[model samples]
Target chain A: MAVPRELRQISDAVWELPVSWKPGMRVPARLYGTRDLVEHFDDGVFEQAANVATLPGIQKYSFCMPDGHWGYGFPIGGVAAFDPDEGVISPGGIGFDINCGMRLVATNLTCGEVEPHLHRLVDRLFERIPSGVGSTGFVKLDEDEFLDVVEQGSRWCLRNGYALPEDLELTEEQGCMEGADAAKVSHKAVQRGHNQIGTLGSGNHYLEVQVARKENIFNPGLARAFGITMPDQVVVMYHCGSRGFGHQVATDYLHVLLDVMERVYGIRIIDKELACAPFRSPQGQDYFSAMKCAVNMSFANRQVILHRVREVFSDVFGKSPDDLGIRQVYDVTHNTAKLEEHVIDGRRRRVLIHRKGSTRAFGPGMEGIPERYKPFGQPVIIGGSMETGSYLLAGVESGDQTFYSTAHGSGRVMSRHSARKKYQGKKLVREMQFRGIYVRTASLRGLAEEAGGAYKDIDAVARASELAGISTPVAKLTPIGNIKG
Target chain B: MPYTYLEEIAIADVAFEARADTREALFVEAGDALMNVMVEDLKSVRPLVRRSFHAQAEDLERLLFEYLQQFIFFKDAEQLLLRVSKVAITQETGVLGLTAEAAGEKIDPSRHDLNADVKAVTLHRFRVRNEPAGLIATVVLDI
Candidate 1:
């Protein structure tokens, strides 16, 4: 896709499309990436970002992070903030998998110690933490019990003996985001999510055991502060979300908003997927409350999965997780909308910030981060392809620009169908094994779809993120074993 | 019922275009496309269980959206894999109504070759188009 002729290079890695780029745009659209990254973005991203700019009450700019790619309405890796009183909230900006995020756990064991028992460990994690299509979690809950889980988030995990108190402390929003309203969620959502507590739902969702050698550390001091005390230390990372619960919530509301958006509110949306209601409206408030249920549901889901990770590791190592020093580094989400206070126009204003396929990288000393890491900023976990390496990053003061947002992962460059057509899952598995990365998957076709060639360069993405100053890399972690869904 | 996947969009999600001469046939084709996304081989699924769905919308677009969403709802809520075996579309008063009878069985991972889970049918590029010869519905399934 050709870069829009009017897109101006405002900075080394930033490009701005003025409001005039599209009709009815209330604000300009801003994209951040190195030149190569920007050039490789799908053609749909620019059009969708411009469309998002037209939404009512969008503030500053409709920002697309370095990893931005074509998504349904707003481009994935998009961020935007709007006034709660006058602005609108759109689910398309939040994604179907609400709070679909990343969690990293550090262990004292080194790669050498882990490599010997790595296969047994990976097999155990895959069995205990279910993956693939239609896989349900070991946790069973009736409708009433499910409601309690969503309302309390990870607190339910703590009560159920699935999580420690510090686990919640290291989590975003303490794993229990405020304002969840169980009454707002529908019975359909309850039915979809009731039994899915610890399972990892499919499509790019996975549990991987990774390793960070000494050379992978970009900022040793920050890494050590986060419990990566030993060279070649092993860690665990997984990505998933609210599963069927979030999808049902988003689907239910999209229908409600579509029926009422134009008819009741008279708001014009370029794409039906961007249909929204004014934040203060009854419909908007109802959707917001319901969305929070999914958010909390996701937090609880990850906490339970973390518990399973610990269980599997303990069983394989024949030692307790604490003995192995399995502590949470941090839990962060990429898909969400939260009410946050930022210095907008030199005044502190509470705005609803939507991050779709983008991570909130609150700078050092920013409100919302754990007190222990106050001087180092919030930990930002950006996952990469199963065949590539991932990154550990810290927010920077300069991140205030995109409302302290950063790229979520090595964003996709190829479509799944295209990648599937080009790669053989069986061969890819063998090739990966030869490269010292053990692999297991629930679906071979899915494995083909997620071939390494499908994604952008993670090293380049991390460098672009640092150069753009949204977040700075703390360390790089290579995948030693993978369990793909 | 004739439908072909439109090669996944830029993201990992899949899209398909379904067409037929009648709205009823369009429903069948679209429903088949949705089921096909989750199950690698539709032929592998047998009519071991049967279920019916009813949806009412003000327009064709919303009706199609609601109808397709039923399969995903059943897949998640009931652990059932289904295909539209029979369907009827009625236009009465101001409401567009659809009554569909679907048949499949409990998702047996051993029997039904499973693929990606279709999270929801997205509104992006969703359409029900009328033509001289027939009707066309373009749907995108978020995997």
Candidate 2:
């Protein structure tokens, strides 16, 4: 669809829709993208952004990043912060895959060293890490122990010998978020999560081995600080979430909010997908608490997988994990609502920031970041499609305008069915192999659905993010191997 | 058509319309449509494993929601990739209840050509309505 008629061009990379553009909008809607990207955006992006502006007690503006696309209620790259007292908590704002984020591990091994074993490494990694639909992980928790898994997050992983303590420190919220009450999560959700702790769920989820290219390093010093120092440095990136646990939590809460939204709060929503409850209401607090459990579960999930990744590298390279120096660079969640303090209108106030398919890009000196990362800012891991390659970026000062949030991935441009119709997964696999990227996948059809042509250009999306000044590129990593779930 | 996949929704998601002469048939067809999105062929699924599911909701629409969610729950929890074999719906005093039977086997990558692992059935444009022919259900799935 064409750009909204009333959208005002704020800059080359920013556009705004005045509150008057919609009847009940409490704030304006701001979207970040270059002209070409915005022009290619799905129609739902504008509709969802406009609907977000009308939510209760929205602060500043409803924002969409460069890779914005049509999601259920919010645009995929949508970011909106709400006042604690007057605003509402939306399940749609966080998405079904709660804490669906990226974890980057920097290894001392280089492409030159891994090239001979790239195929074997991919095979071993795929075999070691459970993935795809209905895949089960090594961790199985009973009722009581499951609570610890959700409540402790990566801390549980550390205690269970699944992660190093430093892994948690490099993770957002230190890998464990507060306010999680296992009792708040449904028994069904627990059942779904129990056997799936470390399994990577299907659909756009993957584990990729990549090589950092020196020419792509925009900020060499920053890259070095984040653990990348030389060209061809090998890194592993995993993209996943709380498995079925998070999906169930969102499903359960959406029903609750739908039942109470209009009657209890007298709130009107344009779409049922945007269902929510007042932040302080029992229903809202319960959902929030349950959501935190999913958030922590995801952290623990990735932490366990990180350990498995380390094991595979050690086994393949014949070096101890410690000797390999396969340290976690960072882990950042893109789909979540965190209670944070951001300065708005010259006032520092606590707000619930909802980042649906948007990564947290807190700039240097942000209060919540770790002491070591304070100087270089938080590392934002943006995973592109298998073909386009990914990037390691750092939050920049200007990002405060978007509440320190940025694009999460190269958003899809074609439907799965369309991609399947146009491309063959086996052929694509061969193509990737010919290009020197080994691939292991569960389903050929599923693989075809993620054809590179189906997504926006990762380079262009990253450029728009930098031009918009929300985040600055640090280093680019090209994939050497990939495993798809 | 009992059901036809719709193409207007976002590229990352799957949307489809299910229709039948009765709500029960519509519900059955809807479940089948959901399963078809994941597997290349529904007939390939054997009835070696069977499950019984019961759901109740304030209305028919919500009942459909609960039914579809059960399919996803089973897929994740039991590793059962099922097809709705039978569906019976009862409506009384504005409440709708459903009893359904699903039959299939575990998802085997070697045996089954999987397309997508549907995360959940979303409420985005989700609805059931009566039409000239009978009833129609429209659903957008998060895959």
Q: Per-candidate TM vs. native? A: 0.98, 0.99
DockQ agreement of candidate 1 with the native complex: 0.73
Per-residue lDDT of candidate 1, residues A152-199 (tens digit): 999999999999999999999999888899999888889989988888
lDDT of 2 by residue, B94-143 (tens): 88889998899998877887777888889988889998988999999998
Q: How far is candidate 1 from the true structure (C-alpha RMSD, Å)?
A: 1.2
Candidate 2: residue pairs that collide: A415-B11
User: After aligning candidate 1 to the native by TM-score, how far in Å is the CA of A226 from where it should be?
Assistant: 1.1
Q: Which stretches of candidate 1 lie over 4 Å from their true place?
A: B8-10
Q: How close is candidate 1 to the true structure, as a TM-score?
A: 0.98
Candidate 2 per-residue lDDT over residues A118-162, each given as its tens digit: 988999989989888788888877767988999889999999999
lDDT (Cα, 0-100) at A429 in candidate 1: 92
